[model samples]
Target: MSKVLTVDPSLCTGCHRCEMWCSLTKYGEINPSRSNIYVLRREPAVDVPVICVQCGLCINACPTGALKRDGATDAVVVDADVCSGCGTCVKICPYGVLRLDEDTGVAAKCDLCGGSPACASHCPQGAIKYEDINKAAARRRELWAMACAVRIRG
Candidate 1:
């Protein structure tokens, strides 16, 4: 019953609060570059929050075997001691969530804040949520059904 981070792009306001909290909590600084969650902004006031889905792609991509899933949280854990600062994991991440922290000299991404995600907890706009995978999928399906109903009625 591991929970996963979910994002609602439509509700995001590009506030970057999630990034700030993440950076502060993990690195004790306000550097967004070190934050695992990134906000991708587009024209016309669109903001999309990108986060790690813990898909294990980075774990497989790591040549030094630095990345692995935490058995307790199911979040990607980066072993800095074992990591060689290679960018393979960064490049192979399908969501582009992984990045090499210049200060730490190791690949960094969301570790779910050791189970409770700060990004989801501190989001001002309710754009992010942490829930069980099954519940999240069911919610998405419900939203889709509501959208389709609206379209049909209109």
Candidate 2:
């Protein structure tokens, strides 16, 4: 069962705690730009946390075979040595989660912190969850079913 990071945008408070924790854990700093999990602020109070969902589109887009999935964590691992910093992976990423590190010139994305994601653990609003994709999909379907029932009754 592959687990993925899921975000509930409605519950996000835009505190950037996820970003801070991600940067601190990965880079030992508090730079949001370096954080793999980013907050997209569309309005003053509306924020969406953008993260890599392990969709594999970036892996296919990598021309140098630098991106591959880690079987243990199901997270995409970027091989800096093999990567040419071509930016194709970054450009093809649908969620814009991949970024080329300015200093390293290597593409960076969420690696799920080697299976225990810091962002999901530190999310203040319970907006982010790391769960099995099948279980998550089932829960989503249940929610939609309840919503439809309410609409029909009302």
Candidate 3:
């Protein structure tokens, strides 16, 4: 089964540990700019953890065929050597999670660390989780329904 990185925004504390783990694991440095995951804080103290959902939309958009889906992890990965640095994958990515690495000049995004994601594993708040896609989808729907019920009661 394919897994995805699921986010529970309510659990996020905006500590940016996920960013640190991702960068450190990938680049051997604690660089937030190089991290695949990003945390954006809203005005009302809401911190949103954003990452590639492994949607694979960019895989088809890549003109050079640099983007391919990992069958084992269901991750859309960019091949730096084959990538033309065309930025098509970045633009096509709806979540804006893809970027061109400053040093490599190639498209970069989450590869799920081959199977176990460092960001998900190191998240202190459990805000980010690596889970089966079906389970994640069901959980999202449940959360949305609960939110809607609360709003309706309000």
Candidate 4:
């Protein structure tokens, strides 16, 4: 089964270890701006890790056909050679996870690190998990059901 990155905001502690590892693995540095996974912190002390869900929506939006899903990993990847850095993918992404690399002048986002994501593997809080897509969907449904039950009871 293909895998996906599942995020649990409740587990996140804003440690930024995911970002550090991601950038280090990808760029040989600890630059958060270059990391594909981003941690957004809310005013109420909430940290939400945002990343490419590999939904493939951006692939359809790429005019240059730079974005394509890797057959092995099901990861939406950017082909630097084909990418025009037009920023269309960035705008098309509903979650706003895509970006153009400042140095490369090319589109960049999570490629699941060739199927074993650095962000998910290094996340200290277990906020990000690399798991089967079906499992992730089932988990999401369970969470939704629990939330609905609480709402109905209250």
Candidate 5:
């Protein structure tokens, strides 16, 4: 699963449809408890949706060795049998989306929508886009180059 979900904080209206989509996929409910995407406020000014950093903080936080990589891909898998649901992984997640399911008491979050994120599909504002890290980086670089060229001409 690709980890990067590029977000435009400026365009975020904080409607939280992404969270709803995430929860529905994970828990079959509208509850944010199952969502792996976090919506943070930049105050009355903005709301930023934060998802997995893919930095491996939650992966590293797994003390029971429940969290493991797919080896064949970027997907992260959790072994519920080994998971004690101590909330360590949940607490360690910087995005705050990772949460201990109140019902199951197990940690859960966005698993990349099983590689086809509903958030990106359902985003009304076009604020979220799922793409490869390398391609996204290249796009950003191109934007920066455009900015530099415009500056020189102006």
Candidate 6:
């Protein structure tokens, strides 16, 4: 079962707590540079968490083939031995999700905390969720419709 970490930008407070947790868990330090997950703030009022969609942009962009996923764990693992740290994947990520570990020089992303992400659990609001990828959007229809009804009523 493939699970994804989904985010509702509207619920994000731009606190970057997710960024702290992610960096602390993966890099053993509270360094955003090493964090795979980051909170991106854009312009007037847009705060969105940038994380791996597992859409394979980084995978496809990797020239050294160091970026690979563990099938058994469903976690994307980076092999530093083969990685050149050229930063192509980091450059290509549209979401600004992938980032270079300043010390290690390799890119990293949310590996779902080896199947149970701590960030999602630590999130104060219900903005983040670890859910089935196949049925990821199944609930969106209902949610959007409900929002639409509210708009009509108000």
Stretches off by above 4 angstroms in model 3 are 150-154
User: Residue-wise lDDT of candidate 1 within 1-154, one digit each (tens)?
Assistant: 8688888887999999999999999999988888999999999989989888889988887999999889999998999999999899988989888888999899888999998899999998989999989988987787688878989999
Q: What is the Å distance of residue 47 in model 2 from its true position? A: 1.2
Per-residue lDDT tens digits for candidate 6, residues 11-94, read 888878887888788778887666777788997777877667766678878999988887865776778798888999889877
Candidate achieving higher lDDT, 2 or 4: 4
Lowest summed-lDDT stretch of 10 residues in model 6? 134-143
Model 1 regions lying over 4 Å from their true place: 142-154
lDDT of 3 at 136: 94
Give stretches of model 5 more than 4 Å off. Answer: 1-3, 71-73, 138-154
| Candidate 3 per-residue C-alpha lDDT over 1-154 given as tens digits, one digit per residue, 9 for 90 to 100 | 8788899988999999999999999999999999999999998998999988888899889999999988888788888889998899999989999999998899999999999999899888889999988999998998799889989999
Compute each candidate's TM-score over C-alphas: 0.90, 0.87, 0.94, 0.92, 0.79, 0.80
On lDDT, the stronger of 3 and 6 is: 3
The alpha-carbon lDDT assigned to residue 98 of candidate 3 equals 98
TM-score, cand. 3 vs. native: 0.94
What is the C-alpha lDDT profile of model 2 across 41-89, one tens digit per residue? 9976889898888888998889999999999998899988999999999
Q: Which is the leading candidate under lDDT?
A: 4
Q: Candidate 6 has which clashing residue pairs, if any?
A: none
Cα distance off (Å), candidate 5, residue 20: 1.0
lDDT of 5 by residue, 19-136 (tens): 8988887778887656778777876668988876556677887989887765543556667788899988878877676677778877776667666788877788977878888876
Q: How much is the lDDT of residue 123 in candidate 5?
A: 81
Ranking by lDDT: 4, 3, 1, 2, 6, 5
Report the candidate with higher TM-score, 2 versus 4.
4
Q: Give the alpha carbon lDDT tens digit for every residue of 1-154 in model 4.
A: 8889998887999999999999999999999999999999997998999988888999989999999989999889899999999999999999999999999999999999998899999888788999988999997787688878989999
Q: Which residue pairs collide, candidate 3?
A: none
Model 2, position 80, has a per-residue lDDT of 88
Candidate 2, which segments miss by more than 4 Å at Cα? Answer: 139-154
Q: Please say which candidate is ahead in TM-score: 2 or 5.
A: 2
